[model samples]
Target: LLELRILLHGPAGSGKSSFINSVDTLVDAVSHDSFTTEYKTNKIQKGEPGTFYPFVFTDIMGLEKDTNKGVGVEDIKLAMKGNIKDGYKFKPASTISKDDHSYNNNPTLNDKVHVLVCVVPANTIHLLSNETVTKMRDVRLAARDMGIPQLAILTKIDEACPEVKRDLRNVYKSKSLKKKEFSVSLGIPLNCMFPVKNYHSEITTDDNIDTLILSALRQMTDFGEDFVNNLYRPTSSLQTGI
Candidate 1:
């Protein structure tokens, strides 16, 4: 059993929230048509692996280059340092600082961000202007500095390739059709990238979609476990760069 904390990052409207929703749907193996009840509050959300997943996913506000909107680079640095606490609403106009109550002055291995998942929409990856790419690069370099392993999720595959849209079984083979959307152009290694489609418009679980999404989830969980397990090198190492 592996335990880790995964963070989802990307530009606004890239479907981070939708991806989380899809994963929750898959873990419970629940279809919208058969959902029996809804919990008003999610203080203790549970997942797969009997009691709950050994790991959990964290979704934060999107990143934008603008100084007055979206998550700031400084805030992202804080997140990578594991200083930001859960449920801390990100203020687009400002970044997190030591003054904030949610700031974790001394984060432990449990508080550190184990995995960094970059979510990008495949359909419009080319349209991700240099400004956006620059922002991503800045964050990537920051994560790289902290020894955090990052993975790119090239999402919205259904809208990127025709064959994949018709049938996800052709994802890897359809890379030619989706060559432009590939993360190689984004400076990320091809092996560390994944293509997935969220179930935003679906009412039922489609095996192909689940297969792709779950595969990515499993791969990310593995990467996260590696980082968390490695944190035992020394307690001081975790707080050095912060």
Candidate 2:
């Protein structure tokens, strides 16, 4: 019985859009029994048929290594504060401000991002450009400054490790997972990280994939609740698991 805004930030080709589609497919399968895994629509609000997510997941454009391309750090910071409106065109070198037409001058708590979920592809962690990593880190720091709780979703695990691709249950023991940089650089701990495989080639819903997706989402909601409710009452409860 809780709803919180979850903002997704990531680099290009990191599967942010695909992850949202996966959530929609999983909801259809678990709640109903019909889901089609066709090509990715690359659209937002692609979740459950005739259903809406209680908590909104805002997907911004991908970030680039330099300020000259992709999403700017300032724009992301503004987004975390819920200032940027939906469908607002992003500028590579400029960040939105109070004067921007799309800026939400008065954002409610619901409009602001309660949970910040950083999206990074597991397979490319080793190959990330230093500038990209640095820029992402800057975004993370901005979130931290505002006391916003953070979690990261490690997407495309199947492509990262063959063992994981075969059986997702073996994710924890897979020695090949690129967990170091995420844990150390982004400050997302080993426990906070949720490694998931987005639905790409398959048509049917897999329990393993669904579980991973839902589990991560569940935690996101929990943390979001923790941040929002704690604002009014700090010592409610800390035990939220699915």
Candidate 3:
């Protein structure tokens, strides 16, 4: 069976990698400096050996405020169309073209991104630079043109709000995030925005963390399945023709 492809993108240190690790015990490379350069697709292994879940996650380098640094917005557009390949290193100076060795000329429906999740730090929403927000919105518009569903993941809620920090149950009650403000900023609806704390510095998995992660994941799969089911192309088609 074909697995849903979920693509994650956002500013530096927004917890994209950490969220993936929390969702599925996969080992994704992370750094304190917010440097993730490789394009990687992660699949969750099922209980049985050599088996995987019905969905996969793709992680890319974080977006930077500088136009000449970090990942370019054009590269993200290509990724959504499945034009980029795994392990492809991002070049800030240029984007991948048809002649690039890392380009994927033939991409199936499974290779295309079913859902685009923008991961950002909850506490830093108000502090995001104008350039970064513009970059994010640019990518969102591209996804919209391609008919891809988009959502936002607000990470580090504990650090963003003291009330939530005391108890995760107070997530909705806390007024710190100002959901509407960020919703307007990112062009994402209140319903599509999800708040979750990624698993970090914890020796064992916590119920609260798992609940939040699973909640967002369930939503992702739901949106992804809806997109895949509505696709005009056959599931087994190898070329997207885009």
Candidate 4:
């Protein structure tokens, strides 16, 4: 089994769960709530045996402001610490506290996350507030701190005008300028990024949605292959008996 721990992180209602569902039909259990995933990991088998086998992907709880101060912040923190070598095992329900209604704040630095997928809405990119832009930039910074490869997926593309899509990409490119100094400080390249148009159609195949997804997947695989080859070692203890 080729286990890959891909973490999806973004603001609430950014279509994170829907993206997971697109990757694997089994993730349909996910919903559209503000916090659809409450500190849980859903595993799915990607590709076939022998060729690529089943690579594991985890759908993490969506992040929000003041998450660290909330009740579930601890759980979120813990979940974010996992890496490729030692994949995540779901936490038992009995261990969770019923009193904590706030989000989990338990992010651990040891979490071995392979990739960080940031979901952004294409239509709202230009309209985001300065604070939101800063928050998005912070997310990228956090990913860099964890040494995880990061990619931005632009969701709700079908809802945007063609001109808006063009403008969105330009906006994204310009926004990188604001983080150029930060990237330099971290010794990370700022241009290693890809754009994905997701949720183009209610029907997966309509409006060339599959083509967009495939293009995005190609970029992701390229990044993932390099990340896996350079940063991680194969785990011998990963038994397929489950």
Question: Number of the top candidate by lDDT?
Answer: 3
Error of 4 at 42 (Å): 3.4
Q: Rank by TM-score, descending?
A: 3, 2, 1, 4
Q: Write the per-residue lDDT of candidate 2 for residues 75-193, one digit (tens) a residue.
A: 88988887877767777766675787788898766567888889999988878888988888898889999889998999999988899989999988888885776688667887889
C-alpha TM-score for every candidate: 0.84, 0.85, 0.91, 0.59
lDDT string, candidate 1, 125-212, tens digits: 7777677778788888888988898888888989888888998899888864454446566677877888899987887888998888
Better of 2 and 4 by TM-score: 2
Best by TM-score: 3
Angstrom error of the Cα, residue 221, model 1: value is: 1.3
Two-way lDDT contest, 2 vs 4, winner: 2
What range of 10 consecutive residues in model 4 has the weakest lDDT sum? Answer: 83-92
- Model 4 has an lDDT value of 0.50
> lDDT of all the models against the reference?
0.73, 0.77, 0.86, 0.50
Q: Stretches of candidate 3 above 4 Å error?
A: 26-34, 232-242
- TM-score, candidate number 1: 0.84
At residue 8, what lDDT does model 3 achieve? 96
Spell out the clash pairs found in candidate 1.
none
Tens digits of lDDT, candidate 4, 142-242? 66765678776667654555543554444344443233443343233555333445442344333344555656556666666666566534552322222
lDDT of 1 at 220: 87
Total clashes for model 2: 0
Clashes by residue pair, model 2: none
